[model samples]
Target: MKLFNWPNIRLVLMFSLVVFLFSFTSNRNSQRKVAKSTVIFVGNIDPFINQETVNKLLIENNQDPQSIGKDKLDLNKLEKSLNGHEMIEKSDVFVSIDGILKAVVKQKTPIARVFNNGHSFYIDYEGNTMPLSDNFTARVPLVSGEINKKNKEDLADLFRIIYDDAFLKKNIIGAQIMPNGSLLMFNRNFNYQIDFGRIMNLEHKFKNYKAFFQKAVLDSSLYKYKIIDLRFSQQVVCTK
Candidate 1:
């Protein structure tokens, strides 16, 4: 009986050779030069920043892209650069064993574009203000007027409501914050604007509007009036 078969010996030798080659390649690549960086955008966001910009950021932050050692690189610093970008919400940076550097970036979700105090910016889903991007413009609803700490949450909720509702998203093109903490939405279908006063009891307010809209649409009287008011406690008010 053979203690060790020829097939087993061949398999063992092949494995040893593979391991040796991997080790040799790894050692050689230990003094790795990061190749051109790859930018991966996560999610369905229309990227506010492009791959070229991301690569530029990486190059600038990497200190010396020509440096021959991934270990010598402060990868965290590179990641920080991407994270600090106004349009970027979060990011991950890493180098493959083959010296390919990949940067995964998640862009901030802009729920509404705000025009306040003669300045324009984007308001993210988290209610944080994000700087406008020169590369791309978000198609989210436009919002104008002043905001205070008291009505910010209510306003944020309104933005979310518009974003989440298909009919509202399609119909509401813009919004205005009133002095009395009410919201006014621009109508896309009709010439009239919606005075959606406060977001309190939002569900009922929307239900009232939806019902009224459906009724108005049925009789072809949608264009007869201006301004749909949904603020007076579960009632739909309109004027000609």
Candidate 2:
């Protein structure tokens, strides 16, 4: 076993050179200024915030993303700021090797827009309320009248239920919570109103409606009723 063989010496020298180059590259990259910022909005839904807005947010603390050096960039802190935004559901910030400050942002998906007391806001899929965006409006269900904590929770349940069921999602466009605590749904294609009664036994009520809709479609009688009631356990009460 040779202590200082040519192969061993060569290997050590090579390792040293590699480390030196890595250190040099790292040092160079650390000082590299971010050229610009690119925002990527995840998901198929329309973005609530635009690229300009995102770039502005990246520098909201008066730190310019384009001029800020990589070493000076606080990615974690920046991400926290982004996540704290009311419209943002999740966010990730990182600088690319080429000096591009890239941000991946996902906005809260609104399931319904609530209107009450002359105020309007959005209710997301996570049951969180978000302010309406000026950039885009989601074509989700419109929930008007008698909005409260309990009512919002029930509406969230209905939203999830509708979203899960394609038929309900496509047909039911909006809902109304009456002052008497009864819930009503508006059909997209029909002029009649649906009386859901209460939030209890939601699965049963929807099932009954589905059965009635199928029968009505078969008979071409859906338009004959002014009100479709699903309050009872076993039947659809229709008013013509």
Candidate 3:
């Protein structure tokens, strides 16, 4: 082929460089657009956890996920804040790629009320103390006694045992605490008392009650009895 023209060669090289540079610039701009539009996904957040509260906490500490150079979001702190409320038993928080935050909350369920010395407190099924509400009425067992500061734990334990026992819980109408720290249960039918002491080996004591009631009380014409003692290990004593 004839010797290539220098001017034409220079023009061809310049066109090639221009095309390469344009493509490189376009790719860089595209990449930057994608980076700016990056989103995060968060889930499992309760609706009750206000978005404004989360924003405030995040902004105060410069922990917002959306902010450049901001500290990573502290999941533990967020969860603690949500769970600190008396009404919330459990809570979860989630962050989305699109900078959305989600929160979910589980409310405490009260199963019974403990009346001690005049002040009343609610006990949940899981043996946790729940704040009493005037608007809410629960048809659970009522426990009353000469309760002191030390007696609260014992009362909570008693509630836990009773709630776990299906047979005794169904039959129990209410519970009373004797001066000796013993528990007296009131049944739905017939004015009788069940002496369940301190709730040690509760499952075993409950089983004993079931066996005795099925054999002696259910079949017998004795619908009325004075007291049924389930305090003894593996034995039930009835006083008529």
TM-score of 2: 0.93
Model 1 per-residue lDDT at 159: 80
lDDT of all predictions? 0.83, 0.88, 0.65
- lDDT (tens digit, per residue) of candidate 1 on 1-240: 885999989999999999999998877787777765688999745868889888888865446554547766677888998899888889999888778788899998888898999999988887778899887888889988987687777777878887889988787789988887778888787899888877688878887888899889988788988888888875789987
Candidate 1 lDDT: 0.83
TM-score of 3: 0.62
Report the C-alpha lDDT of model 2 over 1-240, residue by residue, as the tens digit. 998999999999999999999999999999999888899999645878788877777894696878878999999988988898889999999999999989999988888888988999998888899999998988888988977777777778878888778999899999888888888889999889999998889888999999889889888798889999999998889999
TM-scores of the candidates in the order shown: 0.83, 0.93, 0.62
lDDT of 3: 0.65
* Poorly placed runs, candidate 3 (over 4 Å): 1-77, 97-100, 220-222
**In model 2, what is the error at residue 197, expressed in angstroms?**
1.4
Model 3 lDDT, residue 199, Cα: 48
Instruction: Sort by TM-score, best first.
Output: 2, 1, 3
| Lowest lDDT block of 10, candidate 3 | 32-41
Best by the TM-score measure:
2
Better of 1 and 3 by lDDT: 1
Superposed Cα deviation of residue 125, candidate 2 (Å): 0.9
